[model samples]
Target chain A: MTAPFKGYLRADGRKGIRNVVAVAYLVECAHHVARQIVQKSDDMDVHLIGFPGCYPNDYAFKVMSAVTTHPNVGGVLLISLGCESFNRERLKSAIEASGRPCEVLVIQNSGGTLSTIQKGREAVERLKAIAAETPVVDMDVSELVIGTICGGSDGTSGITANPAVGRAFDWFGAQGAACVFEETGELVGCETIMASRAITPELGAALEACVQKAEAYYTVMGYGSFAPGNAEGGLTTQEEKSMGAYSKSGAAPICGILQPGDIPPTGGLYLLDVVPDGEPRFGFPNISDNAEIVELIACGSHVTLFTTGRGSVVGSAISPVIKVCANPDTYRKLSEDMDIDAGKIMEGRATLDAVGQEIIDSVLATAAGQRTKSEAMGHQEFILTYKAFDPLGPACLPLKRA
Target chain B: MPEALILLHPTDNVLVCRETIAPGTVATIDGEAVTITQPIEVGHKVARVDLRPGDKILKYGAPIGSMTKDTPRGGHVHMHNMQSDYIPSHTRNASGGAA
Candidate 1:
């Protein structure tokens, strides 16, 4: 079956569902100015994203570089405070290297907030013009890189939405689209089972080690990824929530492991390890839901499927998030904010396969440019912070191309 | 009639409430009549069998946590009686709103 959609063609030969002009603030100091520019521009296609750190961080720089060059991004307008440790010149070069239009504004050099806002607005107009010139091309499902994440999970998550998304992932993986499921922090109890699904024994071993690392890291932090909201929603333990979140990966054979900026080399199932490597010095691995969404976008996911039992209304800057509500009650409360209601599976009014097909159909429709509930409501949430990681070992990416 | 409780897996000793079950509600469990001893909200778990303090709480046929106290059949299985073997779960009240 050929699933076809019209997409903005990038110079790197990747297809983008959205042609967005990103107005990025390199430091927290420039955030106000950059935000003003996006707000004044008043265009849904213009988005705001940034790193708030004034200190130098390799992880921040790498994620910034990955997001700016993401296929969904058409052009970029970078705002710098001029005194921050972030490498603006290198980031601009990386964006330009991908053949996308990029410009940087220094708030200090451009005469502070008001003047920079004016100039940034003008730059956004120019970038939008260049972005609009991107040719529209017919794209197929095989070229899509889709990511799945479960947030605000509960007992019903595993029973409904999460497994339904798993079925969707299975379908997408079977169709040869790159399917990524994430955060070893949430995979604590399922590591052994997940490893058994890996294509090679070496990759399987690497998968197990990644989860062990997450468990150790969280143990040091005095907290697991399990949150208060989870307990309130009937999830009693970290492992229970982990099992619920684990269903989002579906049943596909694990292909490889990916660090934040590592794009999948082939069309298959990949596990995105969001936990920082080495000692846990940087607090929680992901501060919030949006951070994980950003990591998924950094992995070059064209779209993300977010399954929620407690309900989360978040859409990323570069990609669309399809919210699949697991609880019928939450779906009733946030009906306007939800995309698919997998809660019906519990009522027996609909089957899991039916909801899974509905999710896939919603993805194809979203890929073809139908706005998700969050997107239509103008939810362009983005966040980035400090973290560190050593390069992935050879065993992690057995299928990686040089 | 809507199913009051569902066993996710054949081996699971905990049954999940398909809908809210109020106190004194009569529900049939495995051909045996049992009365709901406490309020069980939708998506919450109930003991499928008599559970002891050291017994593991099984859901989806996997051990999720351990029981901290004895719970009779159809009793609510939640944070009050079960605790994680990996890490302690926090609540808004338990962590002083830090959660």
Candidate 2:
């Protein structure tokens, strides 16, 4: 078992790896003001996040509520372009209910852009002050919620960094931590194998159905999640990439399925079904890596493990992302940006077990307040786009012992 | 020292290049010496045996894609010779932008 670390205790009794004051814009028109507030604050802990849609969306509202109340979040400052349709009042109420300091500034009522930005900055300072007053408490691995995602993937990702992350996930899950692995669209061909690892037969069927939804959604969109960077880095097909991405889930028996804003009921392995439930209306399930990270944060992931072969340099707004480089060449090129080099396994300098242990150590250290490379370089990238998802079915979340 | 190629699974018909291999670089495959015919970058695959069009290309002991063209042993097995059984992979040429 891992030793307990000093974690920020939230009002709801959840523990956070980081204490962040989020500046959220209800609409795109207010995004500039929110950005200015965060930029002027000169505090890395104050991050910029928002839904850029003018129309109301249940999915967006749910994700925003979950994120604002996330364990990692200490407080929230809302920026609203007064006439937009986003329910800023309801969002503020949700934050207040979570006992976090929350303030809303309307662009129109607050005298427009310059004034809103000024007020937003002041609100951020107050939130940050309130966040700093959060009590520090000893938190265990069982209290942590960790997420894993792969970006800029290549063929090397499967054999090295990805499987290494899987091993780490297995370890963390065994230790009673909620370990989530996502990108159902990427799990196209491995549905059978993935389902076989589910704890119950009913949950297994749900797993297969979710992957089918992802396949159907991607088919309608006329493109799988496979990208040019993936091919350029030697990944040939979406299924091949799926097989690679699937390895990040490890061999842990998946306890349940979770949608974007659904928190896992207990600590164990979880498969986050990121694809929308209905016929494909939105362009892609997740626009970019950060979108998935945001969803993971919304689901209460305290820290996220990011594996890459071609390499990506993105972190999240509230949670810190630990980049595990798969290919030795990519690691050498982007060493400064990576947290763990699982590529060392490919180079014969380290074994998968060694690299996996290194990843766990890094997670423990990160939870203990060590700054990740992305965090140090100030890469708190966040994005929340419009999407629709139905509530999970009964079988989606099998009862797991807490 | 790192080997030129690494076989991921016993049933896999493709061996992944451990490093950027140059033409004429010799590698042992299935206990037989085969010389690389083209420059294969790390993470890319090379044919373990002669492959014909429509043959399922196995990697990590499962079919990842199928061969669209014949490839000799030690020849590169990638986008040029293989195609996905499900979705067609998009590149910069098709999307007209970096992905």
Candidate 3:
């Protein structure tokens, strides 16, 4: 079988489904000006993402580096409030080292906020022109990294979209694509079952331990990752949600356990341990769905499959999000926002295999340059904040095992 | 007949309501007819058999939680009578949440 998509070939020889010029604000003080620059550029490919704090955090630097250097990013414009300590110079050098056109503008050094926005806008315009020069290359399914996340899930989600995505993940795995599923907080109850899928006994133990970390972390914060609306949508407990979420992995062997920004050395299904290593310092594992998706993109995911039951209308900035609706009822109310109707499985109008194939078809189409509903609607929502982690221990990456 | 309630997994002790079942609606379970004791919304769970307090609630063939109070078969099973066996869940999980 041959790969069906032609992707943007990057200078590093990696391929990307989207070529985006990231306009990132180093601090909250520069966010408005960066937003203005992206707005003035009037390009769908110019995306906004930023960290709001002024603190110098190793974790933040790592995440920002991974995100800016992501294969999907063709060029970057760094907007900084000169007083902040986010280290814009290092980031600018990183982008330049990778051969992408990069420019850094400090609100204080660029002649204040207004002139900076004007300068940033011109930078984006120049970046767009430079980004168009990326070579087109035929990328195999093996070269693609895809990720899945379920949000606003309800009772029907597990039985429908989640499992369908699992099936799709299975197909991708068989074809040698790297697949990622994340949010350890939501997988608390399924650790035992999830561990059993690991490629080696040691990796299985590592998988179980990460879920334990998430369970303990959320417990200290006074809430499980299970949300209130989950109850309203007929989800009664965390384990049940975990079971449903577990289906998104399909039946693939757990190839590796990765932390945020850790790339998979090869193809197969990998579980991203989003829960911070060590004790809970931050309030929650992931503040929002986009936060998780951003981590997946940083790990080199070209497209994301987002399964929603209660109807999440979110899309990411660097990668296109294919919203798969799991509830027939929710799909009816938000048809325009959804890309696939896995909910038909509940209605008995469609089978899981059909929807699974539909998801795969959607992925290939999106990879081949057709815009997703969210991308066409201009939903480049992105956010990055602070969190720390110890590097993945030997068992987590397990090169010998995979 | 309204779309019959479903048993998500063979070992599950809870029936997922595929459609809303009004109070007193007689539903079949394990070849036995059980009358619904309360109004249950779609996506909610119903006791597949007589449930006693301390009984582990099963769904998708896994233990989701445990009963906090005794309830007859076909009775609505939710947060009031059932609680998470794991950590305390967010109490206000409603329509509004971060995307």
lDDT value, residue A213 of candidate 3: 90
Using DockQ as the measure, the top candidate is 2
Give the per-residue lDDT digits (tens) of candidate 3, residues A153-271: 88888889999999999999999889999999889899998999998999999999999998888888887777777888888888878889989999989999988888888889999
Give lDDT tens digits, candidate 2, residues A61-90: 999999999999999999998999999999
Docking class of 2: medium
Pick by TM-score: 2 or 3, better one: 2
Q: What local lDDT does model 3 show for residue A15?
A: 86
* Model 2 B-chain TM: 0.92
Q: Ten-residue segment with the worst summed lDDT in candidate 3 chain B?
A: B90-99
Model 2: iRMSD?
0.9
Interface RMSD in Å per candidate, to 1 decimal?
A: 1.1, 0.9, 1.7
lDDT pick, better of 2 and 3: 2
Stretches of candidate 2 exceeding 4 Å from the true structure: A400-402, B97-99
> Tens-digit lDDT track for model 1 on A1-402?
755999999998878999999999999999999999999999998999999999999999999999999989999999999999999999999999999999999999999899999999999999999999999999989888999999889879999999999999999999889999997888888889899999999999999999999999989888889878888788899888988888889998999999998899999899999999989878999989999999999999988999998989888888999999999999999999899999989888899999999999999999999999999999999989899999998998888767
TM-scores for all predictions = 0.98, 0.98, 0.96
Off by over 4 Å in 3: A400-402, B93-99
